[model samples]
Target: MSPRFLCTLIIVLGFVSCGLPAKRREDKTKCPHVKAIRNFDLHELLGSWFVVQYFASSEEALSYGCMRPVFSMSSDRLEVSMNFTYTFTDDPAAELLYGNITWEIPNPSRPSHWVHAEDTYEGVYNTYVLDSDYKSWALLLHCAEKSKSPRYLSSFIMSRQPILAPNVVTYLREKLPRYDIDLAYMFPMTQTNCSNTNRESGLDRDTVRYVIKQSESNRRHPMKRLHKP
Candidate 1:
């Protein structure tokens, strides 16, 4: 099969098998052209962050709980990797899913902007740090597009703590509408009753690197799913 068709098939299979949320259609309007924050410090942004609120134009509602991502920057500061663990909100067992996402800083001058470096991802995926304070809270925007296709957008409001102050949440939430994010669906993620389950799936630095390495070695075909559960 051709690469494009294989990509489509992989995406469809991912949504079906991973308990991933089925994608909802976006508003017909084009994706908003947004800007990354100026002088975004990669060092300051490194570390664990709890996702306080998540907004994906492609999702009608929230699907994950206890969404946490730990960011690590390479010593050279050219590559950034995210090791995250999350459970589906509807899941009774609350089974955690571990995933890795890596990106490269195409331009060190624009450290806030990154391009997905994983071959598994089939599109032109770009991540932007719209705003952040590096201590208490942060606002992030991610956009992806492929030839002639409508861009896909998703955002995260992250806090160093499980819960962010309401006023601060509101402050960050206000920044997304300009990018055409719907306020009503910006769902709060549940951080209660969550913990690292086993040693193998632990999100520590060593474990994350091992898991990612294993995944990289197993990728033998273009049809492998791009989006992790």
Candidate 2:
């Protein structure tokens, strides 16, 4: 296949995977919500979090070793800056995937629980801190959107350090069933070369264009989770 053909194919896949119908599917089970750590300090949570375990159903897999989410306080909401490295299906060299997601605490009583401040197709996107000590390990639950058939859920076990402790991983895994999340679908995310935030490739423009086009397509067809189960 010609290089141009491969490029065009990848662009098509990106848009198709991202573009989906936007219809709210309700989950029969009441959305899961573990109690947020009481009196959790948002200031303590403001910093870079290394994603240890990721549970998502997206068709695209998250790039390993570069999934870092940096958070900072902006007014009444939390500003999130996420950076990662992902490549086209067969391409080896990695490209950057960066975006900002803003979250706000709707209830002052539950400071650790937040809702998407920006428009999100995932109806009722809620992010809650299930457990965290503010120094070592943090367990997070992202209820992306509850669908009628398959629920779209994402949870993360983050840590201050790049690597998570073995015991913590075990504990987080055991906690999945309560939320009806399958442990088999969960996988550890890479934290390699995390310090090198400037990593980029010649295909940066292509990557950006694909992302932009995908986003626009999603706006038109906004109801489905892009990840495949």
Best by TM-score: 1
Tens-place lDDT digits, model 1, residues 1-229: 8866776787777644334366765553344566656777889999999998987765677777888899999999999999888876644444567778899999998899888998777677888888889999989887776555566678889999999999999999999988877899888989987874535333566665555465554322211222332
Error of 2 at 44 (Å): 0.8
Q: What lDDT tens digits, residue by residue, belong to model 2 across residues 17-101?
A: 2344546544543467567676788778778777777776453354343556777776655443333332222223333345556
lDDT of each: 0.76, 0.62
Residue 212 accuracy (lDDT) in model 1: 49
TM-score for candidate 1, residues paired by index: 0.72
Q: Flag clash pairs in model 1.
A: none
